[model samples]
Every structure is written in structure tokens, then in C-alpha cells.
Target: MDGQVNRVPDGGFGWVIVAAVAIINMTNQSILSVFGQLFGGELRRMNEDTFTAALITNLNSLALNFSGLFIGPAIKSFKPRNVAICGCLFVSLGLLICSMATESWHFIVGYSFFVGFGLGLISPSTFMAINSYFSSKRGRAVGVSLAGAGVGQVFMPHVVRYFLDNYDFQIAVLAMAMVSLTGIFGAMFLKPLNPPLQHNNRKHIRLLSEKDVEKCQVTPQAETVHQPSEESFSKKMLSRLVQALDLELLKDFVFWSIIVGMALVYTATINFTMIFPSFLRHSVDLNSQLVATCMSVVAFADIICRLLLPCLTDYLRIPYRVVFLLGTLGLFVARMFLAETKDLRVIIAMSVLTGMMKSATVINNNLTISSHCRSEKLAGGLGLSMMSKGLIVITVGQLLGWIRDYFDSYVICLYAQSVILFLVVIVWSPEIYYRYRRQKRTTTKSIETTIEAGVEEVAKLNA
Candidate 1:
């Protein structure tokens, strides 16, 4: 196995990993999506202000993404399976703590920090597993895995609402804790591939072989080499640390563009979803039932797109970046329509479009990064992308709220989000075009050169 080249199965057990990841995603997202339903009444009864509630939510997101800074090292040290299992335990424990909490700060400590950090671990581990297992079908596999989130979003609310209706808050939270434990079973399936999919592992083998050869050549009486100075040793250690973290990815223009574009699209789309109900009820003067219907439509549409869009794109052989760009542009158009319309039917249509476009963006977020990174560096790329997203969300997320407060309008917020999407489209559109043209020109020149060489060889044979 050490001498053999690493090759992705692209099927078989890879599909099992996909299923396991999907279940993990479903379990994690079910708990996360229903946070409001689980804790909203309790927080209100405790006399917590909306600002405090918002802070709790923001803290959760902050912890989830900021923790990415450590995930690469964690996965490298402990392996994905162990990391995922530990994450499951952390989430379960956090929920147990949340069930017993009596204060806002308690909820913050239990739910926001603990559960958020757990999710941070589980997410990237599962993602890395999927990327390791498949190559040709990666787009479809990612879509299928992330569809679990949509499934949780669509159905978990009813399940949580049932518990909230039948039992006390603590009992419902306790039930959720038990539900979280199922992810441990899923995590157990994350076995490392034999021979592994990483080139670095093969490189290490070659290095060891070279050392063996050197040992064979050296004489028994050779003097031992002196150790390096402390300063040089420290510099070497620092360089290794930087390489492990893949900090060099930050120096790449393409990588930077991908992370920034994803961060902006994610910030805009997610924040919009968060405030969509408010927009519908207050700005559109929609009734409660209609608002609920709109939300349901969005969820259904989102899940359907998640299940189908990536598969369709892969079958069509469209580049992930191109699909991502189209999604962003579609989002910009959808938001513009949504902001301009007051009709219920038009709003519903826009909601569907928003869901579909958002699904495209979500499916391709990591796909784009994986396309750019080698197998070994994938973990670092994903971690850094998450870190960037966390920073942007923490800062710009606050600004979105401020824009709403300053204008006293959700409509203005919608416009701001559209502008964000437009900016991403502007940044990426020209780059994608330029790259396509350059590749085409290179191909054309190669074909012309080959033809001229063939003609010259035939003429020499005739002579």
C-alpha cells in the first residue's frame, strides 16, 4: 500500500461516507435550526431583551467559525473520526447544560460557545471526509450531504414544536440532547482511507526511503552531526507550523477571491433569511399564516434545489465557480424583485428563487475551494475559508442590523444585501472570463503546433 499510488474510489464505500455525513449534517442542523423555537419563550419569560437574544445568536456563529482556526491542527493530530465523535459529545453536553440554565449568560455559555464549537469540529471533519472519498462525483456528493441541512430545516421545526407543546422546556431540550447522540454513530464511519488520498503521505514515504538509503551508505564509525542552534531550530519549527496551517493559501489571489466572495454571499443570504419573516409581516403587511407559508415555501424550495442542482450541474460539466457566480447573480435579481414587490404571489415566487439560488451558493461554497487546493491542503483551505467567513460575518452582520435600525426598514436591508451580491459578481465575473479565455488560447496554440509538426514529418518522409 505504501508503494501504490493513492486513488479515489469515487464510489462504493465513498457513498457510505456520504450517507454518514448526511446523517451527521441532519442531526447537527436539526438542533441548530430550531434554536428559536427551543429557547425563544424561555428567554422572553426571563425578561431578556431582543438585543441580548441577538447577541447569543451572534456569539454562536462567532464561535462556530472562529474555532476553524484550530480545526486543521485538531484533525491532523486526532483524526477526523475522533474529532467528530468528540464534537457530538460536546453538543450533547451543551444541550444538557442549556436545559438546566436559569440565566441568559448560562444559555450563552452552554448553547453558544460549547455547541457552536462542537458544530465547528463536526462540519469540517465531515466535509474533509467527503472530499477525501470522491472526486468525479464531488459536486453531487456535497449536494447530497448538505441536503441534510435542508431536510432538518424543513422538518425539525415541527418536531421541536411538538416537544415544546407537549413537554416543559427542559424536557424538550433533554430530548434534543439525546437526538444529538445519534451523530456519534455517524462519526464512527469516518475511517481514514487506506494509503490515504493525500500526496504528502506518499512524499513522507519517499523521504523515509531516502533516509534508509543514507543509512545503508553511512559507516558505523561516522561522527554524529551537531544539532542546530536554538534560533535556527525555532525558525524551522515556525516554518513547519505555517505549512501545516496552510497559511500560504492566503497569498493566493484565487483563494482570497473565493473566500471573500463566499463570505459576502453567505453573509447576505443568511442574514436575509434571518429577517425574512419580519420583512414579510411588517413591511409586506402579511398575516401570520401567510408569513408561515412563505417560510415553508423557501425551505421546500431550498431542499429540492440542494438535492438536484449540483447533480444537474455536474452532469452538465459546468465549472463550480460558474455555477456559484450564476447563483450570486440570481440572488441579486431575486432580492431586487422581492424588495420591489408587495403582491403575495410575486413574493412567493421570489421566495422560491431565493431558495434555489441560496442552495446553489451553499453547495458550491467548499467545492470551489476544494477545486483549487490539493488533497493534503484541503483541510487548511476549508479552515481558513471558515475563519474568513467568521470575521466578515461578525463585522458585517452587525452592520446589517444597524442599516435596518437606521432606515427603520427591512426593504432597505434587502437593497443592501443585493448590493453585496452585485459586488461579488463584479469581482469574480471578469476573473472567470479571463481564465477561460487564457485556457482556450493555450489549447489552440498547442493544437496548431502539433499540426505543423505532423505536416513537416510527412514532407520529410516523402523526400
Candidate 2:
């Protein structure tokens, strides 16, 4: 197994874990992205307003992402595999129930609550497990893992539409439910990393070193003192709960910046998925074949970029934040161009480019979140980020639906999304500058210290 408690396994079973995560995300996240395609069918099935249809999708997104708040705690207490199995079961049940949905609340409960919660549980646990396996090739590994979802996005939409066209929404939902069950097979392959032990004195957590034993010795006296502090079971449980949720992560500036900045990118991408199809079909008066072709191009481009960009970033040794910002710029340009374009071919090209930009950001999102986080804190960090994503989707989602209802303008939506991305760049600019300054200062100080040491050595030799 090549298991090392503190260090990443880097290979061996880690690749299996990555493959497992890839499959898990393939089933879960693909559906999350393609709900835009499902929106019109859901609307007709439920006979709902635009806002209501959008809300259904938003709730699904919200639940899937909002459930991340608890996944950190759950996976910390239970094994990753165990958590994923439960998620798989929940997702299957949710989809099965959704196939029979006769009301809005049915979907809200089945798809949003159950399916979303399952997705939330699966992603963090799998990601945390995958992270324990690789360090150096982490970017490439993450890109590969998420690319499964991209691959699914490439084909699942078309498959779903085929069913919708030939049969009905119920059959499509039922078929998806069957696919959800496959995740359980993948979940079985997800192995947990070695458990961490508590340090006796300061209550620090430490995993075993290569010796397969605790490398740091602990005093009996310190252990005794720590035991007494744990006498209050209620307090200990409450503390454990809070720690599990990683509420402490909320105070971190870097974490906050990452989530907030990604939120803008997410808001735009999510809105695109929810509205773009309908916008093309009705608003632009595009034929169904052209719209479908554009979507397929976008999905395929997204898949290619998801696989390619992370490797490229690793090769170039670019910072994830820098890569993320560059993607934001690309998307902003695409969106602004979309707003100005009425030509079908230009829009199609832009859609592919938009997908490429969005996928680049999505592939980097996990790397960006985990890059600055400690191993113990990674799950909570991702959970919190997902929570933020959920909230943003909930807020912007309704506004997008309302915009469509009121204005009937996809161009306006693109413009609005573009403005938000611009704001993200504006907000992130100073932070990037500050980081540059800090790094420069650190380098200059190290050089001055080296120069001083050399001078002292010369003085001693001369004397």
C-alpha cells in the first residue's frame, strides 16, 4: 500500500482512490452541471414559472453544496468509504424518488435535499482521501479526477436529451438513478489514510511517521493533564462538533479570498448552465440542432481543458491563484463578446471558449482550496468553500431567473455575469499585489542574511 502516516502515499493505492473519486464525481457533479438542460422539462412537467423552475435547480445546487457544511464532520468521524457509500445510497434514492415527482416540493425534497446532500458528502470525503495520496503531482491528479465529471458533461447531456426526446422526463430521471448506483462500486475502492493520534501535551494531532509509530514522545504528566480537560463530555462533544465543521476556517483571510473570488466565477458559470440552453433555443431563436451542437462543443472543449490545463500549470510552475485569475479574465472576455455577438457561429465559438475557461477554473478550484490548507483542515476548508458556493448559487440563481423573466435577454445575463467577474478581478488585484510584495520582501531579507553571514565569515578568517 506504501502507506505513510504523515506523508502522502504519492502512488500505489492513491491512484485507485483518485480513480474512485473520479467516478464518484462523474456521476454526481455531471448531473449538477447539466440541470440547465433538465430545467425546461422540469418546468413543463411541474407546470411552473421560470423563477420556480430556476429555484428547483438552485435548491438542488444549494443542497448539494450546502451539505458540504456537514461532510467535513461526517468524514472526520466516519471513514471516507463509509461516508461515500451512504452518499451513493442517498443519491440513488433521491433520483428514484425524483422520477416520480408530481410537485415542486417533490423535486425540492428528492433532488435538492437527498441528491444534493449525497453529492456534498461524496466530494469532500473523496477529495480528502485523494489528497492524502499525492503531494507533488497533486495538481495533475486533481485535474484528472475532476475531468471525469467533465467527460460525463460531454456525453450525459446528449444522452439525457435523447431520452427526453424519445421517451419522457421520468425515463430520463430513472435512467440517471440507475447510473447513480454505479458510484457505490467506486466507493468501495476508496481507502482511508492512517488515522492521526493526539499529542499528549498540547493536544496537537500527529500521524505516525515512517517507523509506524508516533515519532514525538509524550510525557505521562502532560497526558494526565489533558485527560482531565476531557472530563466534560458535553463540552468535548460540542468542541468536537465545531472542530469537525471547521467553523474556524471562516476566520482565515486566504480561505475567504479563495471562496469569494471563486464564487464570482461560479456564479457566472452556474448561471450559464441554468439559462444558456433556453436562451439559445428561444431568446436567440436558434434551431435545436445548432443549440445542441454548440452545447456539445462547449462540453467537449471543457473536457479537454480540464484534462490539459492543470498539467500545463504544473509544467509552467504557475501559481493556482494566478491561473484562476487568468481564467476569470478569459471568461469575462468571452461573456462580453457573447453580449455583443448575434452571429450564430461567433456564439458557438465563444461557447466552446467559455467552456474552456470555466473548466480551467473548475479544475483549479480544488487545487486552489487545498494548496494553502493543512492536511487535517482540508476537508473543512473544502466544505466551507462548497457552503459559500451553495449560498452564492441560491442568491444569484433567483436573480438570473428573474432577469430572464423580466427582460427575456440572455445578453443582459451575460453582461451581468461579466460585471461580477470584473469585480472579482478588481477585488483580487490588491491581494495579488500584496502577495508579490511579501514574497519580494522575504527574498530580499534572505539574500541580506546570506550576505551578512559571508561578511562575518571573512572577518573571522581575517582576524
Candidate 3:
């Protein structure tokens, strides 16, 4: 397996993996994007407060992301394909369980724990599979895969609404469960990369030279020297676990900053998506069909941006952090504007802008980490990022709900989301400027040193 780690096919079958991941993402994201539309109204109808609805909604997010702590190790210990398949089964079962729910706790257990954890498992495995397959065009590959979610967003709401309009709520959820089952077939296509990628100190995947390969080769005699006592075995297991989790990444300032910024941004944006439908229904007084249309408009806009923006950024050679900051800032402005407006046309325009900004941030979410971490540690970095986001969402997400209930307005929630996004911009903008200045200084110093060396070489030759 060590022999093949360096030779990424870069394309070819990698596109196949990309398509499979898109399918999985489409399935996962469609359900999440409309979770509130599906259950929030019903919960409200049952006299459950906004806080209870938010609790149930965020619980799924919490479980989905929190499980990343275990997901990293699980992917390392098992095949990505197998892990994904298991995740699909869990998601399907969870949806089925949701279909039979008679109480709020049932939704919490079924959707929050089971579906969330299942998605947690599927997400990193698919991400790792895509990363393992592509190196040079990773931006485009990730964009294409994420575009699947946009496609889902475009259609799933209407589909869900159709079932709700024609059939019962339980039937709609059951249909969703059957739809989730299709992800298993996609998971099956995630054939393990031969000589699977390994972690190293380098941030990028590079081909190992023959000399490096020789150095990596282990001698039988060296292996025999390590006799495993019970204590030694336990230590070895602990070390392996730690290695798999990539706990060392916590020490990186840039990584931690990215994690925090992305977490806050994600919490704000995702909560908005989950809550927006409810806001439209209760506050804006939009009908179900109109709300579905608005969601589809957002999805349509999202799909256009997801398909175009990443590739454009890659072509322009834009720094991922810069793009992320711009996107977050745009989201903040859009949310603020959205908060002040009740006009449907203005709201639709803001939705379009929000979707575009969302695409930018979502594309860069993992790309930022990938730029900072070693290729092998990508899974761990992503897992830890998800875990951080999960923690923040559960805490802050509930707070948003409380703000809505206390103030008796979803507009307050929108303003609160804008504030959180503003914080992300504040945190990242200065850091980006600092990095730019530092890199410029280093370039200037290197050029001056080169000029001095050239001058001395010419003087010596003339003499």
C-alpha cells in the first residue's frame, strides 16, 4: 500500500468517485436543507415552542457533527466504502423511525441521533475518497460534488411538499427514507485507493522520490526489536488512536482560526436555512407553495454559484481564505437586508444573493483546511472541524431560537445570524491581511538575497 500513495490518477476514475460522492451529498443535504420545513411547522402546530423546534433541529446537527470525533478513527480503521454503506443504512432507518414518531423525543432519537451520526459517517468518508483520487483539480471536483446538494435543494422541497399536499406527513418521511437508500449504491462505488494515502508532515500530496521511498522501507530486524508487553501494546494502541484523530492539528494557529471562523459562519448560515421556512410561513405569511418556490429559487441560485464560482476561483488563482472572507461578509450584509425587508421580491433577491455567498463559503470550508493540513490528515482535520462546528451550533443554535421566542420575531434571529457572520469577517480579515503582508516581506527578502549573490558572483568574475 505504501508504494501507491504518491500516484494519484488526478482524473479518470476520480471523476467517477466525484459523481458517487455527489449522489451521497445530494441525498444527505436535501433532507437537511428542508428539515425545518418538514417538521418545524408540525412541531409548532402541536404547540411546541420555537425553542423545542430548534432543539430538535439542532440536535440532528449536533449529533451529525459531534460524531466526527469517532468518525475519523472509524474511517481509518475500516474501508470508506463500508463506512459509507453503514451510514446509508443508519440514515434510512432513522428516516423510517421518524416516519413512525408520535412524540418530539422520537424525532430527536430517530433523526437527531441516528440520521445525524449516519451523515457524520458518510461525509468524511466521501470527502476522503474524493481527496484520495484527485490532487490538482480538487477544487473543481469538490465543487461538482457539492453541486449535487444544490440540485437536491432545487427539487427536494417541492417533492416533500407534494407528498405533504397529497399524502400524510408520515408518508412523505417514508418516501424520504426510500430515497436515502439510493445512497448505498453510490457508497458501493467508493473503491479503496490502492496503497491508500498516508499522513506526512507536508501539507500537499507530493510524489515520494525513490530515495524517500527507500528510507520509508522497513527492515525485518528493526520490526523484531519492538517486543510488545501488555503496557507497550496499550501505549501503541493509544498512539495509533491519537495519530488517527490527528489531535496535533489543534496546535496550529491557522487551522484553529479556520475551524472557529467556519464553525461560526456555518452555524449562522445553516440555522438560518433550517429556520427560514418557518419564518416565511409564520412571519411573512407566505403559503406552502410560495415557500417551496423560494427554497427552489435559493437552490437554483446555489447550483449556479456552486458550479461556476469554484472553477472561476481556481482559474483566477484566488486564495481560498480571501474568497471565504468575501463570502462571509456578503452573507452578513444579505442577512441584514433580509431582516429589514418583508417584500417578496426583495426577499427573493436577497435569497439569491445569500445562496451565492453560501456557495462560496461552503466551497472553501474544507479547502481552507486542505491547504493547511497534510493530505493524509485531511480526514482528521475535517472531522475536528465538524466537531467544532457541531459544538457551536448546539449552543448558539438554541440561543437563536430563544431570541426568536423571547422577542416574538424571526427578524431578530436574522439579525442575530448577521451578527455572527460579521464576527467571522472580523476574525478572518485581519488574519488574511497579516498573512499577505508576511508573505510579501518574505518574497522581498528572498529577492534581495538573490540580487546580492548575483552581484558578488559578477564582481568575482570581473576581478
Query: What order do you get sorting by TM-score, best first?
Result: 1, 2, 3
Clashing pairs in 3: 1-195
Which runs in model 2 stand beyond 4 Å of their true positions?
1-6, 33-52, 157-172, 196-241, 458-463
User: Which candidate do you rate higher for TM-score, 2 or 3?
Assistant: 2
Per-residue accuracy of model 1 over 1-463 as CA lDDT, tens digit each: 0121248777788888888988888888567789888999999999998888888888888888887888876777667888899888888989999999999999999899999889988988888778777776888898999998788777778878888999899998998888888999999998877544443433544564565456556555552443334565557556656766888888889889999889989889768978999999999999999999999898888889988998899889888889999999999999999899999989999999988998899899888888778766778888898898899899887899899999999999999999999999999999999999998999999999999999999999999
**TM-score between model 1 and native:** 0.90
* TM value for model 3: 0.82
Give the clashing residue pairs of candidate 2, or none: 64-116
Instruction: Report the number of clashing residue pairs per model.
Output: 0, 1, 1
Q: What are the lDDT figures for the candidates, one per model?
A: 0.85, 0.77, 0.82
TM-score-wise, the better of 1 and 2 is: 1
**Considering lDDT, which of the candidate structures 1 and 2 is the better prediction for this target?**
1
| Best candidate, TM-score | 1
Model 1 regions lying over 4 Å from their true place: 1-6, 194-230, 456-463
In candidate 3, what are the lDDT values of residues 358-433, reduced to their tens digit? 9999888877877777766777888999999998887887687679779998888999998898988888888899
| Greater-TM-score candidate between 1 and 3 | 1
Model 3 local distance difference test score: 0.82
What lDDT, from 0 to 1, does candidate 1 have? 0.85
Query: Cα RMSD for candidate 1?
Result: 4.9
